[model samples]
Target: MNTLLLRPDPGHEKFGLGPFFRVEPLGLEYIGAALLAAGYPVTVADLRFRPGATAWVRRTTPRIVGISCLHALEYDRIIATAAEVRRAAPNAFIIVGGHAAASYPAPLEHDLIDAICLDDGEEVLPALAKAIKKGLPLTEVPALRLKTDHGWVTTQPLPERTSLDLIRLPARHLVERHRSGYHCLLFKPVWLVETARGCPHRCSFCSVWQFYGRTCRERSLAAVVEDFATAGDSIFVADDLFWYDPERSMELAAALKKRGVFKRWILVQTRTDLITKRAEVMAAWRPLAKDFDIFLGLEAASDSGLEGITKDSEVTDSVEAVRLARELRYGINGNFLVDHNWGEAEFQELWDFVARHGLQRAGFTVLTPLPGTEFYEGIKARIPDQPWSNFDMHHLLWEPKLGAQRFFELYAETWKRSILNTSGEKSLLDWVRQVKPSQWPYIIRVLWQTQRMMKPDAYMTEHALSRAPLPEPAARQPGAIVRDEGGQP
Candidate 1:
């Protein structure tokens, strides 16, 4: 049977760091590897290219179509893509799965979709395809919410978490044609390497831990070393927690060194406390790359703010992490969550922290209530109907305590403190010096698009567009101006 896997272009990539990075769909590639090993012909199409879902369906003529939904903001787009696939390949068995779809299958439980994979696709995809190929009931497949004539029904659960070693190396050959397009910042033709899966930390604003049941799984050290040695010079490690196990991490680093693997750049995401406690493990891995960068979740500037979000780590850990990484000659890229409830003092505190630590490279995001988390469940009913795109963490989902206009002004001001602000410390010339002449055009375009985050008007305009008008009162004076207590018409 011929199967097609798709990675849809996030429908709303106009804002945030969307313009800065575009990595390959490592998840679909892994699934494709599994299917191919099962004797199924597989085609992985990245929908970001021209000739979209409908076109790909006609060309591939696939018996099974898998669509990826990685973010909550892409929910609407995924549904629309499913409809297109349904029209193009009416007989195709359509399934949607990824971090988003599996975590909260409710958004994807539509007639257009045949099932939603509630677990790792590497195991689920092969089994689902086998069931269909053998003319067996899909109910026999584990870890799925299968669609039936009656309604969507849950299938038997997987006996255990899907092992990461199922596929030694992803079917990267499927996406090789688009390799040059995959990048992070100045690193073109980047390779995405996943050494591990899942996160154990529970941050209220994040859905990663909840989706994976707070479990961290690692691939075999040999598989990881092979992947690192064979991958491109610039790699982005897609692990939710990069150094979760200090011993395993040290072993992996030593294994890679033994294999004589080195890279131009490697980026990994980990927690602040991890860096503080496992400084030796970090030091051991430093020799693997010429320029290694760590993306730390410095979610807040104070202990109280961190505690409020159940971050479990204090502000001092963040300080020490930055100090240690810099001392070890590792590039640091950190992010902080900005709450809508924050007042002027809160913003000032964050700004002070950033300045004091010389962390202008740190990015900021609005504390969004992402779907499939406790945060979203608590506030979903209160929020008026809005596009899932607004949940990009750049748009406001509700009226803020400081009001929309003022809130956006502070938000935009916050972004201006970062190094992306070309009008501030770094100029166009400074950015140009960092890249080759051929890359200048691309870098300039990215910098130009990033400027939108520093403008209050841009955010406010999008915010106003997403908001619905309030219903008028049943009775009112003829010339009366109806306004909330905060004032203004």
Candidate 2:
């Protein structure tokens, strides 16, 4: 093999125990396309589905091995894979990239990983491959950190952003064996596509905008339509914020309609502000992607919590977004944020909101301070051990008003009671009744996964919080302590 690419797994699988987990790693696929365009033989080992990845690396014996460490949760896997690859193929040059590596490359500076990519791998990986083939020094490669005798040295200044047309469509055909594994809620064979890159929002818990150079860039509308046409009947436009610019969204929709292309099930994620504020844009997208579904960033219902997370919308905006989805008969997946700070009442309130709104799909996760985000920097010192496996958002990073076990019960029991009658039943029937007969196998697999998740032990073992450290006491100021209103000093 000339070159082999892999997407590291997230240590453990917690499928329906919490939020959705495995989606295609578009970053590696994009880089794979670039490598192919640059005239290099390449293969993608998407370990999310392909088992025995280390054995495969040993068998292939490629000259260059590229691993994508996209999420902080997958950092543990990155370390394990890098070490195994080094053992399996001692001569292979291992290069690691993706959001986690870009954010915190120091942790991966071990015995294996030859270099860490600090920018978009689309152009950088291809450049490195060329340099390797010609026996040129990688010391001067831009947006790269080569492991030297002293330490990792930064080569060149990282570029801000790359043109979206850098490589048209990811090398998705490479991972076609696992095609049946991807889906959005009830829909099977959901093709994940990116119409644009970067996010404009500054939500404190997220780091996507910062990693993408803190700017919103669009793929030319023509490019967007061309790519959309190829993603079969179901599509998931994986934009960080889809309608960040309403005009561009409308233009893209008009272009798609002109080409006489309409996907049966279209899924996209955007903020509630877009739905409530720009109703016309939602209306326009209806024709281009009928049977449209939305993943709304309705992070928190309380204004204080929303402000804490820097989520730009209000409770009212989320309400309006839900009302509009219900009226339009569009499927809804309203994601809400929760943390250990909450007592039982807060979870109960969120549960009530889902029931009242008739949301067909919903997701809730404990707020984790992932690396690369401001939240992580603020709380890093208090966290005793930075176990990458515990960063899945299912585990709490800090101690709570309620103890960890109580918090888990509150989160699990509340969701169990609220979802089964509401979104759970509705989504199950929708898939069984409407999906193509050929897709029954995939649908049945998904339902089985969901059913297993409903059992009590799944989240307990899968998302067990024993690994999470308790929150440190508040730091005392210079001034002496004083008695409070309740006489507590």
Candidate 3:
């Protein structure tokens, strides 16, 4: 059996944090590993680089093609890539899977796609390939939404959650050619390592918990230690919750130290409450890297705001976490959600909070009702014709209470308060000096591209171009008090 896995060029990466991060497709690498172990020849191509899917398909001539859809914003690009693959390899059984595809697959249920993997690909893809090789009915394969004469219908669910130990090591060799292209901020050639999967917390704005059913699964200590030992010096841990289990995290830190594993830089995401409650665990892991940064889910500025979104943690937790992490010498970079229903007062409150805590590193995003969440289910009917590209959290799906223009004015001002605003506290030249002369070109290019986020006109243009006409009631009744969905007004 021959297999081809692709990480498509997500077309909507020109805005927000897109330029700041571009790591390898760790999911496809793991799936490719499983296929290789099962005696299938595999080729992993990141279509973000030169030579698109058509070129790879012509060269590899694969029997099966798998495409990843990690974010909802990439839905359009994924479909276009699938069409291109179909043209190049008409006989290939095309399957799509990843966070977005598996969560709400309705958008990807097209004639070009043969099936969608609704679960972990490491187990599902190998099993799917085996059935295809044997000419067996794909309906027998578990965890798939298979295409049939009738229509797209899901097959049986996996007997149990796939173990993290399914593949001893990811098939990173497949993506080695594009290693230097992978990065997070100034860390070129960075490695993405996953010590765990799934998040236990249920933040209403997030889809991770809803998709994974609030279950947290960790890899074996030995496996994690081995991964860290062999990986590059700069690593970004892909865990949704880095310290969900304090004891296991502490043990993992100890195991890495025992194996003599250290890094130049490491970045991980976790909740402020987790940091405040599990201070000892965080302390234990701080020494793993010379430059350790923690990305906290600082979702709100006040207790009422946090409660409205069901974050379950208080604003005090965020304050304390920032204090504690800085005390421990861990660089802090977090984000806060700016609600569409917010007024001038609300925006000012967030600004005051950021200034008070000295959190210029924190980023801001509009409160988007992402697919695969309860929030999206409640609000999808309101905006039926909006393009998926606008779901990037930078664009508003519906007109806000303050209207698009004023909302973007305040939104852009909020961004100016952050360190990303080159015209603000940090000059473009200062950012250039931080990196080596060789990296200046890359740094300047990324910083210049990021300036679009600071322009209200840029967002307004994109919003008008991508959005459909507003609903009749909302349009007829301007300046009406629109109740906020999934949060307080």
**RMSD of each candidate?**
5.7, 4.4, 2.8
Query: Highest TM-score, which number?
Result: 3
Per-residue CA lDDT of model 3 for 277-296, tens digit only, reads 98999899999899999888
Task: Using lDDT, rank the candidates from best to worst.
Answer: 3, 1, 2
Q: TM-score of predicted model 3?
A: 0.97
Model 1 per-residue lDDT at 308: 69
Q: In terms of TM-score, how similar is model 1 to the real structure?
A: 0.95
Local error of candidate 3 at 251, Å? 0.7
TM-score of each candidate?
Answer: 0.95, 0.89, 0.97
Ten residues in sequence with the least summed lDDT for candidate 2: 474-483
Question: Candidate 1 vs candidate 2: which has greater lDDT?
Answer: 1
In candidate 1, which residue ranges exceed 4 Å CA deviation?
Answer: 467-489
Which regions of candidate 3 are displaced past 4 Å?
472-489
Reference-based lDDT, residue 290, model 1? 95
Q: How accurate is candidate 2 locally (lDDT)?
A: 0.73
In model 1, the worst 10-residue window by lDDT is 473-482
